[model samples]
Target: MENDRGTKRSRWRDDDEERQTAERRRQEKERKRKQKQERKEKKQQQLDQNKPDDNGTSEPKETSADVNGLDLDINGLLQFKAPEIRSCRGVNNYEMLNHIEEGSYGVVYRGKNIDTDEIVALKKLKADKNQYGFPITSLREINTLMALQHPNIVNMKEIVVGGSLDQIYIVMEFVEHDLKSLMTDMREPFLQSEIKTLLHQLLSATVLMHENHVIHRDLKSSNLLMNNRGQIKIADFGLARFFSEPSQAMTQLVVTLWYRAPELLLGAKYYSTEIDLWSVGCIFAELITNKPLFEGRSEIDQISKIFDLLGYPDEQNWPGFKSLPHGKTINKPKNYVKTQSLRTKFPMMTSAGIDLLSSLLQLDPKRRMSASEALKHPYFKEDPRLQPPEMFPTFPSKAGQERRRRASPSAPVARHGDHLNDNKNENDDDDDDGFIMAAPEDEKFGLFREQDKKGGGFQLRF
Candidate 1:
């Protein structure tokens, strides 16, 4: 009986050990999953914070890029095994050279096609699958670029997925410079003509996007591309999306705050292509004033600046002034002390400039000036109407010795299975005057809007 009892105790001890082992494993699994969720949340927050006003601070201003030839790759959270590109169905036979840029996403490398000796900018997603997570941004950028094409729009030659399910790369045209560089290079604020020229082409590009139902939710000077040839092309469509029906107003949180229009600022809903036009108008204002028109720190401050310049909004002026998400806040502009005035702020501007500014600054989106209509505005018909065609960008072949144009603007990206001779030109990629790295562009807007003191009115964004 003693021996049997001892054996039963030993069996119970073995059972307890097994139970402890299983519990340890379950706890470990739970910890790993929680860690992964935390990492994903952190990464998304990083992307959002990259935009200015996120976390209440601004990102470093962009700088000039070397833009030689190389491919940078980014990885996302998904467990993707990169395919072997050395074989079929890969972005092979391309040589990556120098580093062009490092943005919030990843590094961009300049590349040359081995088959035809053609040049391109290859973007590789950066991040580890296990650590930094996946490259949702690369996919978003590429997806938007694939279906879009226009004179004033940047073009994506191809998107390559390669390397054992781990390394993926996207190949695209390497633009020489963005408008931010142009703004930097010019000592003087862009001439009215230049603003007109840029706006006209931008309008053409936006019109194309609208036709295709793509909304470039993010439009800014930095997003505009310029080559030595004087041409400007719109780039960066990752933030853009299709304009679905009902036009449910997207997050007023898309474009850089300075370039954000009034309706978006007022938290207006039901946005459309009209929003893009508002941005265009703001860009025009910035180009001439060398400053933003309606700059505000917080949403309330931003709307206040607009009201001070454009005057207070009565339900009479903007039928539904009191119906928006935060309509009541704008009810009292004269009460706390309105800030400065846009006119006095930009003392150098002419009366005509003021007229144009007010027109674009209108509270109501419907009453806002349309691109086509603005193009014909008398304000632009001045001594030097928008930059003359001769002064703006021309075909790649005509871009001159500085910019190496291997083909005509109309040339095909591929010839007989070779992508080496894509007719493309690189903009000399630097600008000194775009936005002073000293302060953010939005801050500049606030300064200008607060320059002079105008009373009894306020600018309403919605």
Candidate 2:
């Protein structure tokens, strides 16, 4: 009887243990399932917040990452390494008709994408093995141009890589002439009204570029180009790049020595958008005076030229001037005469213009105006020529991207205007700005590109 009782107790214990094991497993599964659900919700939230929005119906959406706030960690975002940017779009059958422009970078030839029945400019930049630095200037240009599409900026039609003898060919919109050419051929002196119009166009362009987190390190007369219709477009972004994070410190030289800001000229290691604004200021002075604002021959000559025009900047005026990389040991002019006067150069310019110019040409880069801030200044606010913001197109298509090109056979025929060619010829080697057209001087100026070309220049509002 005792043996039977013990056997019953043992059976009961075994059943209890089995039941406990089953309960533990059920609890564990429930916990795991809840945790997975929470994780999935979190992932979806992140994706929804970070993905770029395609908001504009009239245009395409922005790609890559927009770092307007610089909130994301840069290291985590550096996903794209050097890529083999090869395109399969062959150009063998395409016939090269006219040689467009040749420079230190490469040769540009106007050609028809026979397959697409579209006219395109083919830029061939072959990097020599000896040219150790900036071998991928073309690559940098592509990366910069990819994100921008303002009427003031150049547009890349397509990229042809690993084609035609291992060379890279960039097919871009074919513009007739550049601003430098147009200005040279105008023959008449630039009118004050024309200056305001040009400045408005340039300010609008730079503002868009800054919004996109790009610096056109080079901004000068040569870089601006024009089309047959006389619309202004900014071009040449070989040194341009997207700023995924806040601009960091660097010792690299940028911008042309002439338009280079006093800080860059002083060899300050770090820089930001201010550098571009300074160049804009110099270009503004150039347009008004019909001469370069600071014509520095060498690095030192350039610095001297700036001081001669602006003034001798001391640590008291420019607190950070002394610590700059190039500021330590420099040749000071025999007599340090500070000239903070713009009226002397442009007596006809308004007080508003003088104020904007001084702000942009400040010796301290930190004090330099921003592209955004500059846009709201009194110059643009008081601009007598500005129309509605909606009228301003973003890029090479001052004609409007939505505005279709005419379909007539005459539309296909390309004619190079003398005034446009003259503008382009002036800057055969402009380092700062590229071949861009002038801003519309009058409504009727664009009627005939050759005879009555636009009459505006980018005024310095930055």
Candidate 3:
């Protein structure tokens, strides 16, 4: 019995030794695995430090050029992957189509959505040179467009960035035709009813912009786009800015030359939304006459033209006009004080229309009409009544097709592919100074029925 018990004890001791050996071996293997993982993680962290951050920015690191044409250093070829020209389709589900046109700011292209198949206008902003980073103008446009949402305001679809740090693309709702394009295609000047429709839309859009504290520094006809549905939407916000207070100083070098306000021309350091109203007035005149109201050759010529028509500004008309930066330099006409008259320029315009125009074109910035006030102007309520947007005609789908059919071969025809040119000549763009006289006086009518001189005013209907 004693021998059997001793054997059992020896067997139990051997089993215990084997269990201890296995545990130590398991612990040794785990320690080795952890050490290997630590080394791998350290290497990964070093690599991540060299790569660009989430915002597409990276810390400046020392770079040394090697004979292989690769930057060799701690932040070397391994740091930044070569800029790959990848299709935006796999990246953001947008397939770029043909190039539309390039502007001073960016190149615009027609794009399609792979998911929805919706057409979009893709504007690729020009990247700034090294160290400057993303353009502030691009940032401003993106921030502004994202905040504004209205039927009349052009819609920004989404932003798509290329694999390369340099490429930035803004996706916007595609607009078929701009007013400039439409005007070129029209057989005759827009009719009075159509003018009312266009003005109403312009005023409505302006009201929305002003309400949002946004100032469209550039409000040219080319920036106003109209779809086939006759819905006009304001576009091109590269020059736009948000204003918090009226007293805030804004750059006078804003609007395009011809549409620039008198105060801006006089180098007023402080201005308000009145500057936009001035552009609106200019646009209104252009729409009615089918030509620029004041087509000046230069900045100096522009101010001179305004003075020639409206008479030289004085304290009597514009308080503190001479206090402006350029006011002192502008030479006044010798012994010539001209009386301002809209009648002479627009003889066929209705009285209400003239009144609204004068108010919008007021020499004093304070006297200029506000967008909301302009919408409520008696001119809009007067005859002929403002036409519905749906009634407005659409431009030809194929460029110059309608114009060619309407205009004789002898009549100057815009070239077949002229619209495709991205770099449009400024001189050619603004050449629509062809004055279109207002409709004949006999053809005009009032919106309301004329009251019998002796009879009670026309009864109101429910």
Candidate 4:
């Protein structure tokens, strides 16, 4: 009987302890729920206080009383405000003034901003011909221009669209004259000082491009624009692209035929910024002579012209020359002279200038001068200092009036399989030749007088 009473009392004590633990857990959960509700109410009250009234005005935020009524200064804290969101304006925002010129990627037009009354160059992207969603060349041009913001580079204001998805335009700052057209109209070649100034600007711009890991595949006289103040702006980045170390295999069909590098003609699959330097060298020679250094009719003729001027490449000059895809196909003339003719061609050039030019036009891509190195060349530091842009002579704006006939060949259009097909010859497709019809003899001016029969002066623009 005593053992039974003891067991029953122990059972009752255990039940009482279990009930006490359950009550404590319930109270704790209820307390947490009340705290959460209070926090939500406080947040709602703060948001309601800051909300705008019927008059579109909101109450000033109370920084001192914020954070549990602490006497803290919120001004010292880093506050992040949401960025303002905006929609891309339509092409109607700009009034088309006149058609400027058409390029491989787009058609250019002088436009005026309806609101600001500011003049801008509108480039209508060639999207209608593309079967794909959007043209990669247009995307690259837009992305490159947006990333590269230098004074020498043409400024991209904004991108505007038309009624359909196919109609897209890139808005840029209006530049008065292109170097090619200006040179074509000029009575005489540029002065030594003027050349130095122009080259300095070009090199400066090139340095910025290489530093940013960009290779402008095409850099020629027509692609360079100048304003009334004589400021030169590099334009037309349709062929430009970013590169990395170890190099990449890009299409050999890039760059205009006249300004193309020798390596490109010889089927060099892996090339870098050196190709651009080669174009710069050609531009340099053109600036001095007021004529193209090597004006060839075709790819073979172009290579022959390069060899005639620079001499045949050997192991001593260009190592691994035989390894190039098209190297074995090169046909050397029986009477080919083994001597370089740069010095003979440019007799008036200074020793320093000759050295700089030779370094830039080196047969080996490895030996070509870099933009930074070219900038520091003794040629620039020599006599005939660079002329200031302000001192440059202003010319009548032909681009501002009407569309003038382009003498130079257009840039090679990018094809669908261009990057994928390495074995295909660029010459196989006649459409990619970019040959322009010769202008009428009566329309010939300044530089065309002597070389009218040979061909008109080379000038390209965007």
Candidate 5:
């Protein structure tokens, strides 16, 4: 009877132990499931916060990443490294050569790839930090350049990062000289045929940008780069962006003062590709006359300068004239006295060229010539037609550059019916203020000198 009682007690103990083991396992499974659910929720929150709202449009949504405010951790974001720039510290990868140019964005240097023995332009971006880590300008430039591939657009080979975020380098295809530098170096003004070729290339590139839904906010002679083969590539896209939707608002403060459009000067909140067309018009005039079309000292003066040449925008000229942001406030009396005939100003231009210019500089943004339309203009299809890049005249090197510069006379002073006067100054390059966003001019009387040498007497700007 004692043996039977002991056996019952042993069986009860075994059942209790088994039950405890099952309970512990159930508790462990419940904890793991809860942890997994929490992790999934956290991941979804991150994705939702980062992704932009899809409003059912084909246009690339302006995300936080596109603008500023990206939390950039080089360590985490350094997942992408170009094979050419794999080695850091500038030793094994690239050998830094001469410093080329320094602009608002960064200092550009000529560099060589150690591995491939290729020359490249290394643009070191200025890492100015706001609440957002890096400047939106840099981000916009990087993203835009990466997406673009054109003969007339600067080619960005790859990116090189250093130990810190500040040491970022944009590897770009190296070109011999910028238009500004080349203009200064040239011994003669560009030939009529040469000008046509240059304009064709420029407009071609502009068409590519518009087709790709990009807008180059800053278009100036300084930003146009050219190689020895007469290939013109548009560079300096610090202010460029993918075209914004009509409903979205963008900053009006863009483009250099001399190249800024009338609508921007009037504080238009929403602008389109027409702004770039206006800039191209200004550049076109500059190339022909060897001087800026409208040189304004301030925002107000800039508007006045435009009116002085093109007449003020009234309801007749611009449909929603008074409705613009500062349209009514700053719309002073148009300087009808300074309004001269473009034909009279550019006596050398063909009728077709004049027509194209008028279309581009139309007061109504709606009427402004688009890149595509401009490319199709009769000017390009004229008798001489556009010449290939290879046919353009070659410029002499430094040995003869100074003589060429000295030989060309400053363009005659032609402001408000001024007489032709000879002004001789060799180092008479436009003030550095020409590069500034709000470039101011000291003189109201304007003169234009042809760029470079052989085309004529002292190329002059008054």
Candidate 6:
């Protein structure tokens, strides 16, 4: 009984000691927290006392000295300051006038700046559910537009945001008409001088782009915008990117099917600015003929149409033709002729113009005419002097008043495995006896609207 009582007493004593130890630890923790609070209060008080008053008068705070023991004004010594970050304005600042058109990357709207009353094109970027964050194509378009600033290139005024995170809009200078719509509405084809003027402006913009090491992978008639003053502005930089020396392997699935280059159609992975020049060539032909130069439905048909116009490209013309990824897959047409029919196609075009066109549409990318070279071509210097922009006739802007009814095909969305397929019609490969003529007259021409005939056009004042 005595042993049990002694053991109980010892247990009690141990429990009492543990409680005392815990109590002491709690007290120490409380003391440290209180001390931290006091120090924070003291520092805050010192800062308050040192801070300048509303009148800009205060006791001079002690300045720390550098390693040389010389007092320095930190603000004066530090010449660099953080750049002020300005948030984008809300989209509500602009009143939505009408929906212009939806493109592959964004939905464009005709808007008016409420403050300045200036009309602007507001392009709200499309959200991709499959994407995790901002689309890379949209990001490239923004970055490219910001980097390139030229008169003939679309001007990005500012960026505006809507209510949500994905609701971003790009504010740009509003252009009156797109070339494709204008050509569709025209009663007759453009005059030679007018065509020359338009091509000159396009070449100028392309020169600027190429000089900056940028390649506009997509260049179609619908992508070119024209104002009332006849100024041309290249739009849609979703496929544009900076190219470096020793060309890199880029996607072959760029540029629309109608304007894709022959090499690209043949699956040339490492291409440069020549692909854009080929598209420009297609646009040039479209401007002359009042229709798309190569209106093929599929990749095979497109290449066949190209072959029908420019003849089959062999090792003599396009070196390393057999080495391309999809080059061997193309079966040469048995009945195909080996002669270019550009002269027969455009009989009315001057020899200089034909030469320029041929250079641009060369089967070999190495032989393709560059934008700078095309700008100085003799076609512009030939008879019928280039029509000045102001002299060019104005047209009714369907974009401002109403939505476009007959829009051209949107740019091809970037995807994989869209190359030439084996399931295409075998007849397209076998039947290549004659050149494919221009689109039928009725299909190419449209009745001129009353407003267009009356010379009534709209123009933004500011």
lDDT (0 to 1) per candidate: 0.64, 0.68, 0.76, 0.83, 0.75, 0.83
lDDT of 1 by residue, 112-137 (tens): 88998888777766665676556565
lDDT of 4 by residue, 364-407 (tens): 99999999999999998876678788878777787789454555
Give the per-residue lDDT of model 2 (tens digit) for 1-462.
236556435678779999999999999999999878876765565666566667623432333344343333233243434657664576674667777677667778878777777777788876777666435777778887888888877788776654445477888887766666555544344444455667767888999888888888889877877665435678887777666455777545878888887787776756778888988888787766566777777988888777777778777768867787777675566866666567776665668889999998888877888777777778766634444433322323321223434445432212343222435566456542334444354422222232333333332211
Query: Model 6, range 1-462, lDDT digits (tens) per residue?
Result: 236556434678779999999999999999999878876765676577678989998875544433445643422243434658999999999999999999999999999999999999999999898779988998999999988999999999999998998899999999999999998887567767777899999999999999889999999999999999979899999989999988998999999899999888888889999999999999999888789999999998999988888888788888878788878986677886667598978877779989999999999999999999999999999877787889878777998885435557655322243443447576664443233333344532212221132231221111
Assess candidate 2 and give its lDDT. Answer: 0.68
- Candidates' TM-scores? 0.59, 0.64, 0.67, 0.74, 0.67, 0.71
lDDT of 2 at 278: 89
Q: Candidate 4: where are CA atoms >4 Å away? A: 1-85, 331-335, 402-462
Residue 380 miss distance in model 5 (angstroms): 1.0
How far does residue 356 in candidate 2 sit from its true spot (Å)?
Answer: 1.3
RMSD of each: 23.8, 14.9, 18.9, 16.5, 16.2, 18.1
How many residue pairs clash in each candidate at the backbone level? 60, 33, 1, 1, 17, 0
lDDT of 3 by residue, 90-196 (tens): 32678877776777789888888888898888888988676477887788899989888889889997778887867788889888877876666553456666677
Those runs of model 6 whose alpha carbons end farther than 4 Å from true positions after fitting are 1-83, 338-340, 402-462
Pick by lDDT: 1 or 3, better one:
3
Measured by TM-score, the strongest candidate is 4
Residue 379 lDDT, candidate 4, scale 0-100: 92
